[model samples]
Target: MSDRQTPLLGPDVFARRQERLRQELITRKLDLFIAAPSTNFQYFAGYNPGRSERLIAVFVPAKGGSVIVCPSFEVERLTRNAAVQDIRGWEEQEDPWRLVRTALGEMKPQHGRAELALEHTFDYASYLRLAGVGGDWHIQTAQPVSERLRIIKYPEEIALIRQAIAITEASIAATFAALQVGMTEREVAGRLSEEMRSRGAPGGGLVQFGPSSALPHGGPGGPKLAREMVVLIDAGSPVEGYASDITRTIWWGDAPSEEFKRVFNTVHDAQTAAMQFGKPFTTRCQEMDRTARKVIADAGYGLFFTHRLGHGMGMDGHEVPYLVEGNETRLEPGMVFTVEPGIYQIGKFGVRIEDDCLMTETGLEVLSHRVAKL
Candidate 1:
């Protein structure tokens, strides 16, 4: 989205997010909570950050008003953007513990009442430091509330995701069409990234090609694009902070050997099967992962199907609701993630098919167009 259009959440919008969080907190018996970063803070405080370290502590009392503890500099912004009743600040010189102590002083929660739900954002070291203000206020850290909330998409969130997916879909299409023998894998990735940015996508990406595809995350480098090798271009676009993740493995040159074609078709069919069955409320996320692997396995490439079938992608590229084995997280409607099935034989070559899927009210929808071209 453009700079003019902000994250769809406004002050009152944040209040709704907090209402849900407060209910969760109350259920968990948390009297006060300190959350941080773009999504969580934005969810509760309606505040977004251009950079990190802008700490925001949102304290929702079980019985009374909620307060946002912030650095002195951000108090004004928080006041304007937040639906909170009180704005607490600490001077840059003074230890933030002054405000932290004040907020904690009031919340005589049962035991873990005054706690912090730190997402991937909080460093363990920082949590250790907060241990300094130790007292009856059991200042503890837990997984962020917002991360769990963002796993499900709201209407506006789905819109941004659709735009991100469109841009990504177009970018991949262009990349496939632009492919030609003798161009480097780096070149193909560059073409796609520039196109995404030009089409209003956040530029730059994680892409790899050739035998390097064996490395799921081998980003751009000076590797030559060759014939008879699969070009694995995994890229995406972002809109209003929502991101889409997609990958396409386009093989160039003449038709492959009997073994390679059989494997490629099997993977293609595996990707299709995985998508056909992905839907809300399925315990089959791991089953979906296994579906792809089983196909590759029956064809004798099971070991090569590295990495999970997908991961949650919304405000952040990777979020919750991961589609992997050993994970029993139920897939739900409004959930968005990738269904990327691949076979990577290290050092020789790799082939992967990735696409974005949205678990809709009806069933699974391919948000990112899953088309192979090269």
Candidate 2:
């Protein structure tokens, strides 16, 4: 039983989240599970890593709420912000693995054996260390179960995501208004981040621009925005631990070439098509991605549309239920993510329009407005 804490959420919400995890474990036939700071710690535990070295391991049993083995210093922080019931602490001087071993013992099954599970991004060293001490355990690490649990969003999570989307949209609009042909991409991006910071949004995203856009993640600054080049901005804001990602290709000049207009409209249309039928209980993301990719491929920039349509956006910037080929996760009402379809011509220009979208009972609602083309 959880104690009554002012910062804690109601018991029902926490139990509901825990119940979902139990179902995922049962479906995967697991006895015990562990996850590190990346997705497992971020979404499941509702905690972000301040440093890469601060590893967090979450343990989920076949039944009951999970136990977290985190550094002793984080106990107060966890109790204040998260809703976990079983909190295990570890000291830096002592090997953290011992604490984990104890927690796993508490949830021990009848056979003196436990099945281990992990998120795809779990640290290899951490796994080795834990497994070294973990004898008689069938360690199962893969993508299937983690995918099911994280692919969709819940209502409370969606609310924070919507807030993230709102802040990101304001930053994009501000970025354009603050833009000048002579100003470098770095300068523009700095201004964009400042706008969000001023508004109390802590976690910001990339402001990659100009030739930078050519590199996919070419990053910010150094080059000036030329007449024909597009200023591609990929930015986000974190609200209540949920992150919203939005990318828009902004043109620097008023002289929009026919090709430019055509590409922009195509990308825009692709985004619309992918999000068209997004709703509760409809989880067909492969079809949604195909719809977006086909538009770019048919228009003759198939190779240029290099990346997948989008990824799941939630507690972390990226999560499960990825929007790409070979993925079968169904879209659900509470699930929110981006629909970005791009076509980049090497040494030329690339166009990608991204907008945060939520699957609702009625269909889809664009969380942020489409960035206006100049």
Candidate 3:
């Protein structure tokens, strides 16, 4: 387990996040940022009021205070958890869009048109409504703003992610130790899920066996296990709001095939190369992907090694700083992502060794290092 204590994300944390975002707004000349009920909303608002057909949003102004708009019935519950004090509640009979328009009008600049940055998750219908309400608006996506702040995690966030990986690794080890020869893939997946939840992770688990393991994402889990078969288990669970993802492949029953061991070793080598080379403020995302992909390609499995090397992980399983081709984003300290390398041969077996990786001040630290490899 992580030596760091569990982080208590209270109003102060959210307040600091909002202040940092406001500075971004000033730099980008964005007048205001509006977030719908989503992860982005929760990040800035200090709490999520749950999803509903009724409109709910958080407004962060460039120079003024933040506000939250929600249904009248939810105001009481929202107030109890919301970090922002200005809460506007609209009744079912009233149009929530009007309230949004009024809030935006209050934050409008004195000279130019109001430039609004809407969160990425806002639907088209809502966008149209917001656009139609009154004055000239310069509306655009808030992706750049959100990505700037969230791409690099805080120390507390890293601690939570580490805790999550520790829990998931323990769960996977316990479940794998109890496997039998005749168990169905579904049974194994269920057992893994139970093990994760029982060990304080309430997320999900996935399992694949033998021929089904050839598929990268996954396939049906009805196939029964047997001797000389391949087994793949991809498991993840959340600690607090942070997430953990890990993939491990094993040779079940009797392991006697030279090909299976070679493939596993190749994947292991690829992951090691990428993890070792990733440095803070030095490596580009595409460079990391190339480092891992080249290792597999040199081993004569170029075409078989499909997909990107890794992706960013935090509150959402997949976030920013994706380690894929053509992405030139530079690596930074406190960025948490995965380093998963795989080689799949159709109609044969597949091998993937994945671990959550964190870039620290000096080097890349594999968060899932406690888990053993092939």
> How do the predictions measure up, each by TM-score?
0.86, 0.86, 0.95
Instruction: Put down candidate 2 lDDT per residue, 18-119, tens digits, no spaces.
Output: 677777777867877676655455555555444347656677787766887778888776666555767777787877788877776777777745777766
The list of candidate 3 runs beyond 4 A from truth reads 1-7, 370-374
Please give, for residues 175-208, the per-residue lDDT of candidate 1 as tens digits.
Answer: 7788776787667767888898889867556556
> What TM-score, to 2 decimals, does candidate 3 have?
0.95
Off by over 4 Å in 1: 1-5, 50-56, 60-66, 76-86, 110-120, 180-182, 254-260, 372-374
**Candidate 3 residue lDDT tens string, 66-182:** 989998988887788778899999999998988988988888888977788999888888888888983687899999999889989998788889888988888888878878989
Off by over 4 Å in 2: 1-12, 49-56, 71-74, 90-93, 208-211, 226-229, 277-283, 371-374
In terms of TM-score, how similar is model 1 to the real structure? 0.86
Model 1 gets an lDDT of 0.71
- Among all windows of 10 consecutive residues in model 1, the one with the lowest summed lDDT is 1-10
Ranking by TM-score: 3, 1, 2
